[model samples]
Target: DQQVKQNSPSLSVQEGRISILNCDYTNSMFDYFLWYKKYPAEGPTFLISISSIKDKNEDGRFTVFLNKSAKHLSLHIVPSQPGDSAVYFCAARGYTGKLIFGQGTTLQVKP
Candidate 1:
């Protein structure tokens, strides 16, 4: 079963603007959330993460928010840049290091 879901297959944003990526999960066992960006033919690179105990976490231009009640989460990138263009995957980790990932959302940042 797909524990995680990314409803939007793609997202577009202009440079220097906010780019929001969304994710939803049906499993409540997840205690941590993470976001990863993958370039074409390349491995996914870790971006940012948030804990289930917290509502939000921010690092530099990236922010991650978790809503336990809704079983939802989101990643926000402020001042999006062309270099930020890639496929982003939302992931959740259970007690173990095992992670469940949503269908990736391709983000295109216009220059």
Candidate 2:
């Protein structure tokens, strides 16, 4: 039962504002966490990731935090821009290289 859940199906934010996306998992064996941004009809691209041993990871305007104890994680984008509007997927490696992904969160950044 590998289930990654993104409670919000969508989110909207104005440009230059902060955007936050949340994800939760029920599986305790997942050790790697990854966030991917996807555009229509295209494959998802890796944005940020954090290992189970770490608490936080950041790159540029994107940051991801993981809480192993709570089985929860979140992604934050500071000063989000219009280009940041996309479907964000939180995934975790399961039994193999296959990843378990949430339904996805559509972030609409208003111009």
Winner by TM-score: 1
TM-score of 1: 0.97
lDDT (0 to 1) per candidate: 0.96, 0.93
TM-score of each: 0.97, 0.94
Off by over 4 Å in 2: none
Per-residue lDDT, model 2, residue 86, is: 97
Over 1-111, each residue of candidate 1 has an lDDT whose tens digit, in order, gives 899999999999999999999999998889899999999999999999999999999999999999899999999999899999999999999987789999999999999
lDDT minimum window of 10 residues, candidate 2: 91-100
Q: Highest lDDT: which candidate?
A: 1
Q: Residue 6: error of model 2 in Å?
A: 0.5
Output the worst ten-in-a-row residue range by lDDT, candidate 1: 92-101
